[model samples]
Target: MGPTLATRLADWIDELGLTDHLAAAGLPSFTRDASGAPSWIEADGEPLSDERLAELDASLRDHGDDPAHGVPVALVLLARKARLRAELLATPAWTYDHLAEVRGASLNATRFWVHKQAEEHHLLTVAQGEHLLVPAFQLTPSGDVRPELLPVLEPLLAAGTDPWDAWIWLTQPAGLLGGDVPERLAADPEEAALVAHAATRLAQRVTASPKPRPRPAPSPVPPASGGCGCGGHH
Candidate 1:
């Protein structure tokens, strides 16, 4: 099990060198007791201001999403949920008419594909208010749907993520893609295959349990040598 929010907060306080600031604010130090157990913060006579709580809340929210900072999975999931909600809200919604126009296809044809091929082909659409928005990134410059998209989309949809959420997963930088966003990298066939494979793994993870798996460990940094590792520096 990971540390509690209080423990994390206390750690952050020390990590950020905020001991003096907290003291000046008349707040007790968020530190461990001599026995290495958690010590709760207590106000020194004066009540803690709402401003201080708000600041600490925001700080906890940010660090709670980061594993390196010892944030628990629960807080991390909360942060992720907030971010997904925001992404869905900020994402632009396009009408069927607009979608058909962008694809250079008749409305009827577009509707057929959206209704019929969407599931099989991995086309994503989201309902916003009264209209369903089709994310524009799914298409190539040639106005045809990117053939490579379906493979990645299939597993994500099957994994129970909504279209918008699936799209977010595709567009975000994937470690499996060597830090390339899946949507952009889909143009290259070899990379697209890898992207699709990675998407399947993500699908498995999404479907495996209600609780989110732990976030992937951060990549290790290469040690710096005096000269460039390549002879080019010579």
Candidate 2:
């Protein structure tokens, strides 16, 4: 009922100033139908299908709404993809089999250890499909989880931080760690304890803070034109 796909595509084309670029590339210019919805022509003289406009809209959604200032759209897409790849590499998800292989433990024993770590110890575990995933960064290359992690996790969980949030806090850059993440600091026992202490203080502060009570809703205003909106002024 709003702008048709073709119409939206036409709007984006103009907003992005793609007309001249397309022309320079020897591509056909966008045209409109009698109803003002967009149509297209191929680089050749042949007419393009309306489906092409819809496809164009679908592809553009991946770039997100903001066009980075003075950056090419293709470069924006590349940067976005690079950022995603970096994040994925930084916090890899470890499955039971992977952990078992790395730790030299039997699969059953690994599963049992993971359960105890998650439940009794409050280490972070994410449920992904039928598998439970732990962040690989929490473990050392020799395949043991960092000793300093659990103490921090205990305070975080006690303060009502969920496992996922706890994981994020551990991995996020911190001022106390000179802009290094807690996970990286956790490589050193003393630094890891410092991270835990910071977590404890944070949790304590949150636990000590007073919760705000909900405010009551305002009553409807009475009209001054010889009537109340609620008909109470009659």
Estimate the TM-score of every prediction. 0.53, 0.48
The window of 10 residues in a row where model 2 has the poorest summed lDDT is: 67-76
lDDT of 2 by residue, 1-234 (tens): 897655666676677656445544444457767876666766654565777655545555555465322334653444444454346445677788888888899999988988887766556776545767777777778667677677877787678664555665677776766778886787687687788888888678768878656544445557888775764000
- What would the TM-score be for candidate 2 when compared with the true structure? 0.48
Q: Output the TM-score of candidate 1.
A: 0.53
What are the clash counts of all predictions, listed in order? 0, 0
Highest TM-score model number: 1
Candidate 2 stretches with Cα past 4 Å from truth are 1-90, 176-178, 205-234
Taking every candidate in turn, the Cα RMSD to the unseen true structure, in Å, is 19.2, 15.7
